[model samples]
Target: MSSPTPSTLRVGRRYRAKRLNGPYDAIVIGSGIGGLTAAACLSKMGKKVVVFEQHYTAGGFTHSYDRNGYEWDVGVHYIGDMGADHTMAKRLFDHVTDGELKWAPMDANYDRLFIGDRQIDLMAGPKAFVDSLKNDFPDEHQAIDSYMGYLNQVAKALPGVTLAKVLPNLLAGPFRRLANRKAPAFLNRPTQEVLEGLTGNQELIAALTGQWGDNGLVPTESSFIIHSLIARHYLYGGYYPVGGASEMAKTIIPVIQQSGGEVFTYADVKEILVEKGRAVGVLMADGETVRAPAVISNAGVYNTFGPLLADNAPHKAFYQMKLGNVQRSMASVCLYIGIQDTAENLQLPKTNFWIYPGTDHANQVDNFLKAPDEHDIPLTYISFPSAKDPSFAARYPGRATVEIVAPGPFEWYADWADKPWGKRGDDYEAKKEAYSQRLLEKLYEKMPQLRGKVDYYELSTPLSTDYFCRYSTGEIYGLDHNPERFEQDWLKPKTRIPGLYLTGQDVMTCGVVGAMVGGLLTTVAISGLKGLPLAKKMFVG
Candidate 1:
């Protein structure tokens, strides 16, 4: 195996006290898609925004990293709803990147699900998707059609839900009530309940909810709203960023800089400064204070309310109390594999593979969590980054990359939580090695050709997520997408404290597009009437 080397994929300027260009209009606490989107929108509105990112690179989960002559995307695998320019997700992405970010469509069969010995393919396009499923289960065509209807119902009701997040507190309640009256009764119910109402066939429900891992929850626990959002978002098929995941930050940062705004990497914000009962600025880890009238936190609710805010800050107690209402999402371990040959030579497919032990997803997940070794691996997702991105071959000749992701509960690695990254001791390394071998075996089972072709591989536990993304418990999707989670109206762009706001997955749902919407709502909330034109362009156009 080759020794690890430094990554060359860094995208943002290094942060330093001296590099500080002050008198900023707003301060964004993190450079995730949410923060970047908000910054870019504000920049276009002529606001000089400064974004601080604690990692060495920007783009948060959308960032790509390299080592040993190979690169892998940490979070982004396949994004949907990009094939058409009229899509809200596509329009928002274009707006943030100034139309420079491009997407490459995946195969029509974007996602393949393996349930025990049975297999199912989720095809792109609404008609094809339903037709494929009908071909598999010919007797239950009505259930499949009804499932699609629920997705459309959620889609129609979503705009009102989003509008509620940005509206003033006085108007939000009435708006939410009106929206709920018009929405389908099953919108925010448990996904399993809604699906079971449509069909009693266990196999069909399993196939329908096979993509539950996308939202980090099983059908029984996840809210139908989130499940529908994810399912509908990918109904048109998946798309990979043209240049790679890092292209997001690469394209968006220039727009931020176009208006004197900058995204600074290696910038650690120790605390958010609150004075006279309002947010003033932030205190950096280096003991420098950068002041701005508005403070926006993309660090997530846990970090923003628990660590970032001072204990005595106004409404801190209220937020801390509110934190108990939601739980953190699942954490996972990823095995990144690098091969010497090109993806074309290796015959890697652009489609994503989701392997499951059986059709009982919730029970399977429960059993695995109780005794990981005794049960079959609940879920193993494999993505071929090299094959998906058209530019990957030119960037790294004669190379291919594969990523396998599976649940890795934080408690499994809690003993080594205090240890530094990459230096976690032999025992920790041994644990990771065992998990890596198990995951690699799963990959080899599906694609035997790559069994001996793997040139290098590494396993990253939840610890890696904590070290890199600052998700304390290594939760990837911010907060859990359970039924109860949607009831918290407090999870919005505007916080109770004056001049302090929240953005990112915690504010809305989870996913690159979901967080981007959170950023859009934050910009709209901050801009008030001035943001109407921008909102119209993104939401209406």
Candidate 2:
């Protein structure tokens, strides 16, 4: 429990001069939050580590891309619980990186749900959120109150809820006793299934689950647990990184590197190096093998144990079986737009607006996939990156960035999955242009003033996501977070093969906070919570 010598924290910075090195303590594949958190925690524990990222920059899904002087978050638009003074997300980041990152709160309304023809804003704060919903269905006041109560209940039960999945029988005696069985009891139920028991109002339920697309679970498939987390996270409000999405990784990189670790982008791990049935290191794509005692894979389970392992890799079939059963989150078609006018001038709402053609959250994909032409796709998903972070405006004055995302089926770009993006041909271009126009028109419908002010825009299809982010099938949120996904005991930080571990979205839950918390789990597994687990830190920190 003694502090790691200050020298240990500086070891990674001057390893060559330290003259007391052996194998790296840990080798993390991918610099996503989960990986970074694990690396930072390991570093703090005096473990020299190295993180390898295949992309040119770190922050797997949380990274942002720039074009024409404007930047759009590739994945994160805003995060929640970061604003809470002692929130687990904030505490984990602060500890892992020694308080390096900064978070900015989003507008008052975290998200706007447009069902059928009505636009409903989900305001920040529990009371505000429930009040806003009350405006839509005045008669459901009791239901709204009941729902809010459940949100708070779910929040309190999450630690026990999650521990129930990972802790073995010997260590879980106390944890299981502390756990709220009433919480995970609902995990086996679908989001829609639970909503019905809570309320019978059809439209109200649709608005609540409008953002289920983020989790790749329609109301019918998503777990009640996941649904409550997302809705409640934003109930307090959403917070974007002050410097945009890249800051999410940038702030933590120095902390990771300071802990005798390195964060390397553009260093692809060609294979997971194994020795005597345990992970020992990673062979980079360029044939360079970096040795380490342990490996933490932020790459989703499908890629970590499925694709990266060797021909006779131990526990390969077990992971393969898990992959065969778990559903993947939906891929998306994003139109990244760099507008010449300031978002302020456009009077753009700080809260994102998710517009759907109808109120059937259950039939969202069925309509899109079955009748792709008439599908209406979640009409529009509006995000203003400029509004989230004004500092980004200095990089591109007089310009604003807007990104629209919608569900895109695998079939849309199946032919070009292996081909490069821009080279995908005329059909791809034509389809992209049509979808982009549809989204833009919806944007125009929402905000009529900024019709022709778009400076430049381009579509990033599933092919682009795959090429850039290295997702196996262009799935955005790692594995699909369905009701069944949470029930799978196999999805945790530990691995069947010793020294091999998992991280990223698949570990905890999903979202930036969820993924980072997942990294926290891996860190705990690596060093036994820095010799001071949460119980001790509750008073010690």
Candidate 3:
């Protein structure tokens, strides 16, 4: 073994102006899961691709960091649909990582929702999930059954919906219409509306939408499509990457290099070089121009259209119009906690805890946003990373880690956005400390044993998110998963600009798997007929 350096946790080579080996086939900006996936997929098809990341690490949100001898994942808490080898998510992951990345199944009781005094446990497997819910609300069995049926319907309708993103407008228009007709009329309706139509029980609706935090939307505002997708995704329960979230990029990078491609960290992309209305290359922050036939942006639509692409691009007006249709997602604060003892000794469960002030999720969120200090936190999500990842002990012996995530509007932290990280004045530090203490109290509410057991903890505000992730407003998920967001036709892989494409959570939905799937869809859209075999294997086989 080697001694760990400051850059030990980071993957990918450091960006240097002299290291340009292009005229590559594709230049992917942002080494997030979406960008890495696209580069790896294209590389597998004998294309020389290069990925540029502004962060010190490669994995945008998937990267894990070690601090004070403890490691914690930045964004990736858990992923779904990895239990079976034949699943599309599993297959794609295997293909990208060359079967190197592994997954560990979470507890059968994957999520525990604490709604005031009432507690609801969402178990793994369809039958078990329904049974558990039915156990809680015996009188609303019919509604539960109906909800499950809608999930099934959404699952059935998803392929066509995904296909439309890759297909041209001529082919996609008819296909999307057919797919829409096949799906339920209420499929794209507001989640709250759909659930209320099924049953008048507010508590049941709250319990059903407990996982709304997964997509950063309230039941009243989120589209039922996203609601159904997130619900169906975790029906089999959650799974953490076996070697930690960073393993995703660590393993995938090798596959990308197989075809002479590389993912570069600290590679700040200044702008997408457009010539004659075509994205021909990218201008680096260091004043180096790397040319490629294609330019794919895994950065969100705002970054691509607002900053990367020039203001005078051919489709500037069109994209600006498209941008008006969608809105940025949630900003949050995460308290990364480190425990001195081992996870096993500390008795931590792999099950995630979703603590809420009350059953009224939407109202609570609205109230909290209005005056954060006045009201209690709308939702507090607690995840045991050390317990979830089986290999944590081997990596960092006698250490355990926990992450507490709660919504924090960007406006609250806007004043400190321009301040350098770690030097944000005393007032900012005091605010973070206040929030951190409150979050610690919430954690102690469930597991009081961890009160003094916590060895170290640090709170990350929205400013930290903006600094690291480049989300100006510290939006966690790229775009809001609302009804309006889904209706935007421009949120697809292929953009109006020639040789320009979009991928990541913005293109599809949020979540690690969602963005990776978006990357796959972008590969298909870019490859056109050449990608059919890969598509058939993934979507068909």
What lDDT tens digits, residue by residue, belong to model 2 across residues 341-438? 77788777678888888888657668778888876765467888888886866656777888888878767878777666568778778888988888
Q: Write the per-residue lDDT of candidate 1 for residues 1-541, one digit (tens) a residue.
A: 3433555689899998999988999999999999999999999999999999999999999999898889999999999999999999999999988899999999999999999999999999999999999999999999998888888889899899999999999999999999999999999999999999999999999999999999999999999999999999999999999888999999999999988989999999999999999999999999999999899999999999999998889999999999999999999999999999999999999999999989899889899999988998899999999999999888888899999999999999999999988888999999999889999999999999999999999998889999989998889999999989999999999999999999999989999999999999999999999998888888889
lDDT of 3 by residue, 89-136 (tens): 899999899999999999999999999889999999999999999999
* Model 2's TM-score against the true structure: 0.92
Question: Which candidate comes out best when scored by lDDT?
Answer: 1
Model 1 clashing residue pairs (backbone): none
Please report, in order, the local distance difference test score of every candidate based on alpha carbons: 0.94, 0.76, 0.91
Candidates' TM-scores? 0.99, 0.92, 0.98
**C-alpha lDDT of residue 53 in model 3:** 95
Q: Any idea what lDDT model 3 has?
A: 0.91
Give the distance in Å from residue 133's predicted Cα in candidate 2 to where it truly belongs. 1.7
| lDDT accuracy of residue 378 in candidate 2 | 54
Instruction: Please list all clashing residue pairs in model 3, or write none if there are none.
Output: none
lDDT of 1 at 69: 88
The list of candidate 1 runs beyond 4 A from truth reads: 1-7
